[model samples]
Target: MRNNHNDKPQWQPATMTIHGGKQRDEHGALVAPLYQTATFAFSNTAQGSARFAGEEAGYIYSRLGNPTTDELEARIAQLEGYPAGAACATGMGAVSAAMLAFLEQGDHVVVADAIYGCSFALFSHLFAKFGISVDFVDMTNADNVAAAMRSNTKMVFIETPANPHLKIIDIAAVSEIAHRQQARVIVDNTFMTPLLQRPREQGADIVIHSATKYLNGHGDVVAGLICGSAEDIELIKMTTLKDMGATMSPHDAWLILRGLKTLDVRMERHCNNAMRVAAYLQQHQMVRSIYYPGLAEHPAQRLMGTQMHGPGAVIAFELDGDIATARQVLDSLELITIAVSLGDAETLIQHPASMTHSPYTPEARAKAGISDTLVRISVGLEAVEDIIADLEQAFTKAQQLKTIEQTEQTEQQGEPLTYG
Candidate 1:
């Protein structure tokens, strides 16, 4: 049951997404059927031995591979312009496995400073404990990254339009520099799905995703994917993923496959909604600053235009007051969920200072441009007017809280006259 859809030259991305990696069983089902068995039954002892010895290209165990997961992997690889891909249990699982497989104790890694908070912690804490030194750099500065690279550097890790801040990095430039130094370039492409930006096309050796995000288009499941050359993927699969046991579940893979079918449509709507939200935030008096690549005011707007098809769904803004005010706004929101993760069907608003990056020291958070007043929002597929109205109400509530705090402080100061 082999599908040769990839060999067809006439097929485009949208077409490939629907019919790309599908292989029919004997029943001739149009959709790829899920093989739920733990181990494959062999016709004879020799066949089983050969299958175990890698003499045959059939599934030996569900832990290693499944037909439904394979179809999803192949489809994602085709969409990403990669030779192959591997699905993992979660996005961080993919990141950790890729790093552990490729890097050694003595190796060094150069990472973007503005990355997901957990990813930052993984490198700064976990990798460091293993004697793998990681150097964090502002990827927007090519020269800074170049200077940070050492002879022992094995990989340069980055997330473009970085997690909360939306800082853009020149993927091509960074990849070239890393490659010249004999370092592999790994990009977290969670923010911009392959439909919007293909990191492999820009010279990335590997592209990773928290498919829990846009790939799922809903907050129901947690999944991850890694795309790279077949050889590189095989190495990671044989080593980290196999030993660490971070394989994605069959059910999650199936759900993600369903989500992939509508990925292009969902992302288009997400980008459109995000742009409107960013515009509205930029004009609001309460918003001290907005960080969105779509706006001309953004520092990386030009680079984003060159490297990405669109600005993506996430937006970050700073409040005129402080962290307390930011929390007030989040607490007041009726339509948006105050959750930690992003890229869901419903809008989610979070304060990184108190929520995501709270584990990091204040100085470290400052270095990453995560300020006390900063608020991050993952705009969803909701109606633009309704989303704006919810935000408006939140802003009103936040202002009321601010006014009360100021009045209380003034009264306390007035009462201090008796103490003198």
Candidate 2:
């Protein structure tokens, strides 16, 4: 059995990352053992019945819980400063299960207009099909959130430094407004991990993460986690997670457990690299606009230290030309990988309009300020100089492509091509 020292001192974040929720087993193994069994053998029929009926606290089945997955859940919950957490198969699973646990037919949800493409689809398309209504509102201004709330609003969902776009939402203000109407507030804390921000302290009812991203720090694992009150977590675990069967694999949880050890150092490197990259992009002539909270000109710069500990590792910027130019820039990158996923050891870039946020129609995307030329990059743990060098080369290639396209257009019109 694992030790639960109730009188343990409050360790710092760095120490907690390595040791939180971990204890030696009967064999005194330094690393926690993975109980990979599907079902635990009961000593007797009475104990089996008691476990099934929730009268006893031992693990009856892996679907209900596993020692490995439980450690992961507890560790993440401790990081987020919540009483409990539930791990899921994917980020969308955590999102769907968290909301579905409390929502019913005729219930309304107020969500930020800018969110992950899958999340937007969940609220705009899938939930609507099931008779649940959602109002997508601009959450940067708390007043917009207040205006969008209805008497039937059961939940308010938001993503601070919202996916791809990097729009910062006021968690405390929105949470306060949601709580007034007896609605739960769920903040997708995927962008800024618990190392940077704790939404629960700011009044958010639950904190969610796409653990596939920063939490894992490596790109191999595809997983999600939600941290909240013990009651809310139990409800999600019993209903959506148990019946829907989006349980996280014990192996995956073990990988995340390993990843958590270096989270503090990884996040620090990510932030430093991103801040340098955002500055470089800001000065590039081929770039139209840059969105990163670390930049001085960022609209949400004032909220940096107050809301989040750092600006985070993602940067979104628009190219000077059209969608083709943006695509060329991504295609021309030599070192950076062109993948939609973020928070990896390798730097990655992707176009949101055709990639991550394509779930939204053109009209809806335009309304959400996602332009066709916008490109999002998840600045990885790469050396800052190497990351910037790759971007510089890509921009040079994109600019050359633009020049050729312009020259060809002039020739087609029977006009002399003017050189700049």
Where model 1 places Cα greater than 4 Å from the true spot, the runs are 2-4, 8-10, 415-420
| Candidate No. with top lDDT | 2
Predicted candidate 1 versus true structure: per-residue lDDT over 42-127, tens digit per residue: 88989888888999878877778888788888888888888989999999999998888989889999999888888988999999
- Residue-pair clashes per candidate, as listed? 0, 0
Cα error, residue 157 of model 1, in Å, equals 0.2
| Worst-scoring 10-residue span by lDDT in model 2 | 1-10
In lDDT terms, how accurate is model 2? Answer: 0.91
> What TM value does model 1 have?
0.95
